[model samples]
Target: MILIVVGVIMIVTSLVSTVTTNYKKLQLQPTTESPGRDDWHHFSTGSYKLFPTEVNYEAAKNGCRNANARLVTEGIRNKVTRKSIMDEMILPAFNANKLGEGYGVWIGLDDLEVINKWKWIDGIASTNDNTAWAPSEPNNGSERCGMLHKLLKWLINDEYCLVANAYVCEIAKSK
Candidate 1:
């Protein structure tokens, strides 16, 4: 009886150990699946998806939100990263004529709350020196939203919020 009980206990211990190890491995796997779109590209900061279809600022925001992301913002702060996006994502879409008739791609910056005071969608203030604004940009007080202007070598430009333009969305890196 003693021998049988010891054997049963050892088997139970092994099974429990195996189960715990497998559970831990499963837990370490990524939780969020990629959005339905196929063009998601990973960067150091997060994954970005380009939406070449033309849409107004608000509609663009909604589209990104639907994909469990927000419009591209903080990630573009780094010049190298910005160039990577321009080279790998924006340029391809633009060259293929996928970005509609517009000459700009909507980003997440806007001055809706206060004219000339640009703020990202996340409510973070952006400075002129830190951003890649074009010469005489944010010039029109009537234009409250930000975009990457094709005519300006993809430099940032303030545009009318209601204007239809392509957009980029970002899924922040998991914390």
Candidate 2:
């Protein structure tokens, strides 16, 4: 019986080895991930502070999610911090041709189903306008896209999922 058991063990070992080899032979190489579906941004204090680019809202949100960050917004009351984010991330997000007194960066800013109750992609809720949006902004009904108004105010202007200009991305510090 011991001999039979030993023979079985040897057979199992051989089988496992054969299977492993075949698996190795069929191993697939790692493929590059697809780019964002929407515009996205990435901001890190230690890493690059600002990374802004054009993308769809969903893709932009996903990019932030992949970085383990929620979307940032004006609901955050600190004017200085929000301004820094705008200067570093939003202002420089686009090239010289893109940057202007008129055109602005689309941030994680938005007003959801709740009217005038602004929200950020980071899940912040605020009725206060701290981030800047241009005057007469946020005129669209149920529009959710947010852009820097002037410099510090967040303006609700575009549709929630509309494709727009560049965007600003922010990464929250891990608590």
Candidate number achieving the greatest lDDT relative to the actual structure: 1
* Model 2 Cα shift for residue 106 (angstroms): 2.4
Candidate 1: list runs displaced more than 4 Å. Answer: 1-32, 35-38
Question: Model 1 — which ten-residue stretch has the worst lDDT?
Answer: 31-40
Candidate 1 clash pair list: none
How do the residues 27-65 of candidate 1 rate in per-residue lDDT, one tens digit apiece?
Answer: 999866754546688888788888889999999999989
lDDT of each candidate versus the true structure: 0.86, 0.54
Any runs in candidate 2 off by more than 4 Å, and if so which? Answer: 1-49, 74-76, 93-102, 129-131, 149-160
What's the true lDDT of residue 82 in model 2? 63
Candidate 2 C-alpha RMSD relative to the actual structure:
6.7
TM-score of 2: 0.53
Candidate whose TM-score is highest = 1
Residue-level error in angstroms, candidate 1, position 7: 18
**lDDT (Cα, tens digit) per residue for candidate 2, span 13-52:** 9999999998887776454453442343333332222334
